[model samples]
Target: MQTVASESGSTLRNYASILLLLGGICLGSLVGFIFGNKVEGVKFIGDIFLNLLFTAIIPLVFFTIASSIANLQKTERLGKLFGIVAGVFLLTVLISAAVMAGVMLLFPIDQGNTLRTIAAQALIDNPASAHQALTPSAGASLTQVLTVNDFFELMARKNMLALILISLLVGFATLRAGEKGKAFAQFLDSANEVMKQLLAMIMKIAPLGLGAYFAYQVGVFGPQLLGVYVHPLALYYATCAAYFVIFFSLYAYFAAGRLGLSIFWKNNLTPALTAIGTCSSIATIPANLLAAEKMQIPDYVRNIVIPLGAPIHKDGSSMSSIIKLALLFAMFGKDFSAPEMLLAIMGITVIVSVVEGGIPNGGYIGEVFAITAFGFPMEQALPVAMVIGTLVDPIATLLNANGDLVSAMMVTRIVEGKDWLSSRLNK
Candidate 1:
């Protein structure tokens, strides 16, 4: 198991594999563009890959979370670990919100611009359709989201929120079960191991699957998506990159003291690139777990904090929310200069970022959340929200996943000490 784990952690070798996958994607896209009709059949290869990854997500999350928490019951620092992770999550969101607000203020989105008009017209013409399109399918029915019958429904990814809750409850119960619970915990640990082995197998084919998917996606969407919205997309990417480097770097430095940066980059790069391709933090958990393992993060910290962090620690969504809110207000010609409005935006954005699901166009649902919660003018903001949400969701996913690994390291460092990496090295 350790050998398999280390093989998964070979960051330098992962880079080479990543580059080859990237090449395949580029070549596939070029071919798909020139002969989309001929290459259309290859999309199923990508679907197969995603389906395989999806198969492991629920079980991996459940066993990993429950087992990690149960293990923490033996330690005195479970509360401290939770506190540090929560604190890091909150601090990162605040930093993201502040930086995003400042950036929007500096290079304010042009309200009357063509993209805004296109967004406004789409919403104005068919508001309901736009709403249906942007609203996440998973979030559409709160009843379904909250209530689940049978184990299968509970294990479904759409019900991940409930799964996490159930896992936490089970973990606490197991902690209190004493000797009998020890066997159950061992079962869960074995289950987690099975899932990790499954993950290693899945990753072996990820490059092929991801490449095909990217090719199909780019071929289908084409350059028109970017060509039309280059300005805003460019700004979004630039700021996102800045946030990852600056905010994430600071968090790493604080967490690990001197070796923070080195520890982060070496272990983090492949996962960041993986996030870019997967565009779903939930899907990236396998890779994130592997990277955390490679970083020598304590097992308890890696398992518990990383999964929890996926939903809660969202630097990317925070960054994108500010951009979406700022642009929406700009589109509606509202006065964001008011302190109350700014405060409202900040508060709502933080909430949305944390609760937002890790699904395609999930951030658009967040825009809808902002409009409903804060009573923003939906008719005007909806179109702009949809546009920004679609464009920035991938970048947001990148930040979201990358932040998970970083948060794992930081929490590990705080709970374990700064010399954790060096200790592993000296061994």
Candidate 2:
């Protein structure tokens, strides 16, 4: 009885922060519904919070990735970790794409007249948006995406993929430096710790920051959630929720039976909330890192996987890609069921999921790629895809951010064995 009481108290303590965040977000949402655009004033508070996270992200990612690799006892471990991470990322993305595609088949997303209305309104709001060309050439070149000509360009968040590549190279260099690199590796570790502390400090205001952000989102975009978008958005939100509950549970169980599932769901709330509130996988990295730590995921795995996943691994985007394709096909009166079309959709989904978050304006680039690939007129189709993308951004980000944590768990299990969680807890 005493142990039960103690455990209950501990559980309450563990959930206290989540409760506060939830309450703040709910209250802010209420205010938004009441005051509408008047709540835009509060968005600046959220921006300040987001900016702090953004400012810290490049350095944080560099330190975490570099330190994790630099301290690896064997270079072979790096290879194994990378291989597992890539495999898991690809598998999960394919699963999500298939899931969304299946959902679309069961209940096709037809925009009907709503497409024209929404498109017209979008064009009215931004007269130049329809004229804007998001051609493949507009996207970062392969060389530009992976390697910045000026080292200073790597410091920008828009060049995150380049930043990650540079970090890997630096880590490999440090590892190869042997005894001479010990001090530098220690410095990387120390810097990583400092970044973690900075993130924690920024998160202290998350309730307020996230609340304000939610208010802004609801106030500005709440009305747009109606009409033609209602069906597709409903499908997306419901699908994401199902995927979050169902597939993530299966993943956790796969990682370590019931224990993994319990731990993952228990620690997932904060990251989920942060992701939804910020609508950014990059911004939610700090919360995901904290959750990973609480789940007892190995430091090296979480450190490397979560940061890398932010830029590249996007189950949410993969799912969204299929839905976007379905919606576009519906609008253009194309047969989405053709085998060649399905294959192209799947391939594009993988590319968009892998590439979207890594480059500047990548989401738009992916949408444009889909539009042009399907032979849709860019002027008409681009606006529709962008609208859908914006409406689903919050839930999509929730999946993308939290997916990284679970991916870390799976990576740990494969690298550290089936008993990884139990062994860590026992220690």
Candidate 3:
């Protein structure tokens, strides 16, 4: 009975911690909104937190990945693992793009009018600059606009696809190499272990981080920010919901009817709330772990897939990205042919999702990438992404939190002698 009581107490504490953090954010945002620039002080603290998160991300990726790949066996299982990951990844991207395409059909951003409105505005308060170069040479033919060169250049700049390619190649090569490679891999393993511990230490600072982040956001934009981006944000959020409902609904229905839905909801609700409130997966991991335990999922599944999936299989991010690129095309009066959209979808799915891990989850990485790639004013994209992405965060958390379960279920079924793919598909 003490064991049961202890478990209950721990669960309560976990849930309470999440609530406390969220309450702090809301109160801070309210205070900042009312006071405006007065909260600039808090924003300064948030800036430091952002720097710390960004600092941790790059090393975390290189070390963890190097260590993971280094330990891969010479067995054929490595090939199978990559194949499955690649297949699922492509499927996730396709699903998200399809959802976005449908959303576009329903609520197409009127490009000409949006551009006209932007042009008429007295201020280009935060115009992106790199997109300026990519803007089709004023009347460049569709053929040129959708050229192999532009796509290739985008990749060369580590624009999403390029980074994924680099990371995958490096990881796989390290795995396939002999003794020296294994030695390097071991170094990376120790590095990843150290980073995780460092992250735990970092969490001690999160109350201040959350306070500062919200203060800056509220101070700079106030409530008007939400109103300004409401429409696009709404569309983004809806697409995210569509993906969650379509994909997970089917998975649950096929998995165990009401029981499956209950299972997913029970484990997912808190994480989903944290994702919505915090708007950062990195900030929500502790809650996700708490929710996972209640589901009684195997430790192997949680240990492997949760940490990995938080950064990978980011269907929500993919959808927002496609929309962001489409919006950028609109912002600059550039056109998007079918091929460009398709390429953008594929590139974001396969490349952006992978490298996005190394980029700070809620930091300036997206803005930096945009500034570097599109030569756009760095101010706009990250803020824009965050604004647009708010629509998707809750659903993204749902997808992400449950993607771990999906990986677990699929793997468990595979080991249990069931044909996971065929069986689930038929159901």
Candidate 4:
């Protein structure tokens, strides 16, 4: 009974902390909106918070990936693990795009004329910039990603995939190194622990950091930001909420029926809320890790899947891409009924979703894909699309972060059998 009471109290505290952070976001946004430019000085707090998060990213990725890979190698299910993760990831992306497309059709953004006028004025004001933005540059990003010409460049946040590849290679090598493999794995595990501790220390300041950032965003963008794009923004948020509830519930059911559904909601609530506050899936890693620990997921599965899923399992971002493209089509007066256009929209959205984690303001960068692939007039269409991304990023991130944890749960069930959760509870 004492143990039960203690567990309840801890759970309550965790839930409270998440709510408090959310409250901070509301309060900060309100204050910033009210004060606007007058709150410029307060922007530093948000900047510092973001900087701290960025600072932690590399160490977190390296240690977590290396340690996870090493542990999984010992299990010899590494190949099967990757195959399952990839299959689930692809299925989610397709589902996200399909759901988003259907929702947009139902609650379509009907502000086409207003959006067109706004873009026309932007084009008139900055024709040169618009021209440059509109030019096709399809292979530039891919080339840069593949070149690896500069070693120092590979370590940047945007090059996390590169780091991950390197880490996997090193991890596998370490695994094959015999007794030395054990010591190396232990070292990496210790590093992961150190990084986790560091992240916890950083997260102690999350509410303030997240609040400051939201305030700064509101101040910069102004109180009327959401009002200006209310139609699309509201629709996007609503659709994402539906996606989270409907799709994730279905996923939970498929993964473990009633018990999985129960565990999914219970484990994901705090991390989902945290992701909403931070608007960065990477920022929610520590919280997700904590949730996985509480859920009794084995460390190897948790570390391998959650970190990799952060980048690859981007169902929410994929949905956002479709939403953005739909809005752009409406804005530009394009006929969406064309089969080719629909295929282009879905294809580019999936591609953008694949690298969403690497791009800064991924929601915004996804607009670039619109410009290049879907033939949106860059100057006029990009700004409107950016507004949508900014407005919808938090909810999208919440879904993405929650999806990562659920993927962990699903993967654990696959690897450990359907009774995984029940067995953990019994133990």
- For candidate 2, the per-residue lDDT at 164 reads 68
Cα deviation of 386, candidate 1, in Å: 2.0
lDDT of 3: 0.55
Highest lDDT: give the candidate number: 2
Q: Write one digit per residue (lDDT tens) for candidate 3, span 215-306.
A: 66667656653344556667877667766767766655444555556666656777776665554566567776676556554465556555
Clashes of each: 0, 0, 8, 0
Report the C-alpha lDDT of model 4 over 1-427, residue by residue, as the tens digit: 9998986676466456456656766788898988887877886786676567567756766776677668765446678887887777777888888888877777776654455565565466556656543433332365553346787875565455466567777788888886878998999999978876776677667668767766765686666544646666677788888889988898887777788788778878789877866667787889999998987788988887788778657888888888777776765556554676677667767767764453334444345545545445553465456445655766788878888887887888788888888777887
lDDT at residue 387 of model 3 (Cα atoms): 41
Error of 4 at 157 (Å): 21
Worst 10 residues of 2 by lDDT: 131-140
TM-score of model 1 (CA atoms): 0.57
TM-score of each: 0.57, 0.59, 0.60, 0.60
User: Stretches of candidate 4 above 4 Å error?
Assistant: 1-77, 119-228
Q: Candidate 3 regions off by >4 Å?
A: 1-32, 37-43, 78-85, 108-166, 196-222, 248-311, 320-342, 356-380, 383-394, 401-427
Model 1: per-residue lDDT, tens digit, 270-368? 788777766678877889999888877879888887787776678888888887777656644565556767777787787667545532234544565
Instruction: Note the residue pairs that clash in candidate 3.
Output: 128-376, 129-375, 129-376, 129-377, 130-374, 130-375, 130-376, 131-374
Error of 1 at 62 (Å): 21
Candidate 1 has which clashing residue pairs, if any? Answer: none
Q: Per-residue CA lDDT of candidate 2, range 123-158, in tens?
A: 564465444322222343568656888988987655
